[model samples]
Target chain A: MGATPTAAVLDAGNLQQLLDILQKQNYQTVGPTVRDNAVVYEHIQSVEDLPRGWTDEQTNGRYRLTHGKGKKFFGYVHGPNSWKKFLYPPARQLYAADRMKHRFDVVAPEPSGIKPALIGVRACELAAIMVQDRVLMDGEYIDPEYKARRQNAVIVAVNCTRAGGTCFCASMNTGPRVQEGYDILLTEVVDSHGHYFTVETASEKGRAIAAQLATSPASEEQLAAARQAVDKAARQMGRTLDLTDLKDSLYRGFDSIHWEKVAGRCLTCGNCTMVCPTCFCVNVEDTTALTGEQAFRIRRWDSCFTVDFSYIHGGSIRATDYSRYRQWLLHKLAYWQDQFGVVGCVGCGRCITWCPVGIDITEEARAVKG
Target chain B: MASKKKPTLAVWKFASCDGCQLSLLDCEDELLAVADVVQIANFPEASRAVKRGPYDISLVEGSITTPHDAERIHKIRRMSKTLVVIGACATAGGIQALRNFTDVRRYVSAVYAHPEYIETLNKSTPIADHVFVDFELRGCPINKYHLIEVINAYLNGRKPNIPSYSVCMECKRKGNVCVMVATGVPCLGPVTQAGCGAICPSFNRGCYSCFGPKETPNTEALAGWLHALDQRPDEIVRAFRGFNAYAEPFRKQSEAYEK
Candidate 1:
């Protein structure tokens, strides 16, 4: 995609230069920063703003941040924020209406003019964006807001060297190493010589940014080290979900007693769907002003676990917790394949770690297969 | 339809903190808009101008803790076309339902100057326990947005779009790290319904289950995990016995743990 060679070495000190180049090009740089005791995405102006010397410890129903050995900017695994927040926001006003007597005028929200350079994106997140692209951008009814934001985004994908306690991206075949869907790919390498990043340009825009930065041809040894780092991350996965004939098994196991067992501990809280990078369920709200002269139609994120999500004229379809849990699991693991040509889960483990009850999806999938 | 008429709305209170009813007033931006569409017929908290019943919609807050309130809910149910129970109080008996686990006579004597003056039922129960509830909005104090949606949906002849998901979803969407995981704090977010916008977790505190159990909460599993985390059985029992203590799953769990 670019004229320059695929690989180049960037000094750790010059990481700030890359941020400078993006800012100079009128792109708002969004990267990880320490907030609320966890690393979360936020606007950044310098490399210092990045989550340096901070790493996260994650387990089923738990997540904790810890200090790392050295000044490692990208040492932490994925936090709660996915690129979805920037693209499809939590709450958005579709249009506002103004009424004069019986006549009405509707005004749509203005398009966001700022281009965003997403820094420190992981491989699993890149896959998640692709899934969302299919749902929002490539669908029959394209969401103009999502399309505009996506078009203006520049992806800076980071290859993981360490896996969090709840991560299973390797099992999903969507992460640990970024193979595509990035403007520039970065692998942090710390050697006897010094700390640096082996950066690869995958797009023409990335190449332009690379040319402006202070970089040198990556030595074969540095490239090998970068490759080794990603391989280590793959080996360190916390869990794995087997996808062998998973769709058929999930469909067949609709009445399995296992569902009841899972439901026994499953709080039908839609946490899993909310944290899911690819989950795109939404509900719309219509509001009018007291004067009856103005109104607004707002769209916000919704989950299938809610009875209202399944409610109809008579009553709710999925009345029991067992049925709701079954719907979510089946939709994510099986039905998502039919709809998106891929499983909805990216195996980032936000669902497992953030779940108040610590219900593990991998464990459930395994039990269902059995 | 010959010239549509504005729907008459009533807000009723029983044995509650009146927080849920206050939520309706809390809709500062939309209250004026709401008033334009619906006639506030019988809201004692909002207005002194009392309007008679046979209302189009009745939002019953609180629960039945007294015989008078128990009899009152049924009358209101007959008067209103649509009856929606708002908050943990009206949906699942409120925190006052803790009396259900103990002797109310002894409690009355201990708190009141004259036990004879306190005429009350032994058990505090949800409004639905007394009359057929058209809908139940779950929360300690119901989310104002849900209240608006319920009124709007009823007026438009459509189902209200309220989520039954867990707080974990909102917590993640808010970009809050897991309080249970990060701080080893016990949280009811997994079992609790989504409505409070995961407020506790965003503030770095565990969920207190103010919205009640979601579609199906695995309280047993969570209790087991909490036990493994070294939490006492009494502590676990206390967790479930908060806002919606009388809610079935939580009630059973707390009863099982009670010594």
Candidate 2:
């Protein structure tokens, strides 16, 4: 609508001006903050709230916070909390019931009124969100709650310049550089020209916000620096899962005996699915007051690795540890393709880094593929 | 419909710590609400007034560790329309089940000056091992939310929605980075059941397997990884022999590693 979104250079000092514009629009700005020894998303009030000079070291089953080389915010890779916690939430009351003498009156919980401006979103996370959108919103039965939150939200994406020890977004072709799915995309560049962001607007709203900021047309050299940053990130990936016929290979390896081999080390902990950006299974629970006068229905995140997730009328379907592990891996890599037309993994590698026993998804995939 | 009678509920104990039963009492805010809907037929800890059962629902805690408890459970089962076992003690024989791997006579002699004064069983077994259990809630101390949900499901005549998955799921959902991969710590979260909300991993420690094994656990694989991490086989065996030593999958895994 306004001069067709162009590339502009913004000084790092003016980053607060961009956040202020979103705040003035009545959007609750949410961004990364240093909490519990990791970068976690919280309601951020200013640029100071962002995890500046803080990066992380991540490996299979391990993570540590470390200081960055410079005053770089968003230098760390993905943490445990994804944007899903804001949109879908860990727990939510679906409805409540008033118990009467004869029948019950059901009342649905009101939709969340907060409109969040999500800042510093990663490329793989954007892909993960898109995958979730397909599963939760594009389906026949849309999740009304997720729809409301997602619709009112804003996205400010950050292009990755550094990859974590567990990162494989390059292999998934989901990150290092963000192609789309952001209102405003920012590439942080630090050199002799000083610390600044190469900003590009994807939508009219983004352009309008950028227009309000003190910015200049990006030079050829600045753009090159931004591209090189992404290129370095791609080259620095610590893990890779070859996706060449990966879906079919996983399907074929259902009985590859590798399942048992991996299962032996697996504690059957659902840590991978929990840390995963795309895993979205839930279980519903109903609770009543002691007087039977009130009742509530709650929906909480569930995982396939649990025994009750597959509980049938008789017992359980996937009763063995190997079978449960196999179901989860196959569903993420193969079955998701058949069901969702996309692989569930965005190669963020949170699952690998967070596994209590250090079970690497890429390594397992490669083993089965072989 | 006007004269519908409230369902009766009872609580029973056996051979472990009373933590699981205390979890029910710890529902301080929800206790009054739960009490209003069901008749408290028998709960020695909560009320001194004991009512005879034929209880609509009986929540059993602890494991079978003595000949008297072994026989008493059968009688209790007969009186309960629905028998729900709560905690690792009742569902997987608790930490006391460590005796299952060793001789009880030796343990009694080692702990007591007069061994003849103590009368114990050769093995500590779960309630499910003795009689049919309608449902089993896993955890060192059963989650209060889950206890409510299980009771609600039974009263509503529906399937309880407790997950049998690993603690890994909870750890991930909580956004806690993996201690094993990042710190090279050994965690039993992979093979352990989900219910405790992945509490241990959230604190930057490995899962202690307080909830016992998930539906089907891969302890061998976990042990192999522990071995790779430079953990001795005996340490791995001791790891599995904790709270739920008598749980079949864990017991078998520990036995396999035992020299």
Top candidate, metric lDDT: 1
lDDT string for model 2 (A192-227, tens) is: 899999999887777788889999999989988998
Instruction: Give the per-residue lDDT digits (tens) of candidate 2, residues B1-259.
Output: 1267889999999987999989888988888767766778899998899988799999999999899999999999999999999999998888888878778888798999998988889988999999999888998899998898787676666667677767777666666656676567788887877788889888888889988887567787778878889999899999999888888989998999997
* lDDT of each candidate versus the true structure: 0.86, 0.85
Instruction: Estimate candidate 1's alpha-carbon lDDT, on a 0 to 1 scale.
Output: 0.86
lDDT of 1 by residue, B1-259 (tens): 1255788999998988999999999999989878878989999998999899799999999989988887888889999999999999898999999999999999999999989998999999998888998999999989999899888878766657676767776777676777776788889888888889988887878999999987666788888878888899999999999999999999998988887
Over 4 Å off, model 1: A1-6, A95-111, A139-141, A242-257, A284-297, A311-317, B1-11, B24-31, B38-48, B51-59, B75-82, B152-158
- Report the error of model 2 at residue B57, Å: 3.2
Residues A1-370, candidate 1, lDDT per residue (tens digit)? 2343658899999999999999988998999999877888989999989999999888887788888787889999977677788888888889999886678898998877668899999999999999899988897879988888888889999999999898899888898888787898899988875899999888888888888889898998998888898899999996998877889988888788899898888767676777788989987877754344577888988788877778789998998888888899999999999987889998888888867678899999888777
Runs of candidate 2 exceeding 4 Å displacement: A1-4, A97-105, A243-257, A286-296, A311-330, B110-113
Per-candidate iRMSD: 3.4, 3.1
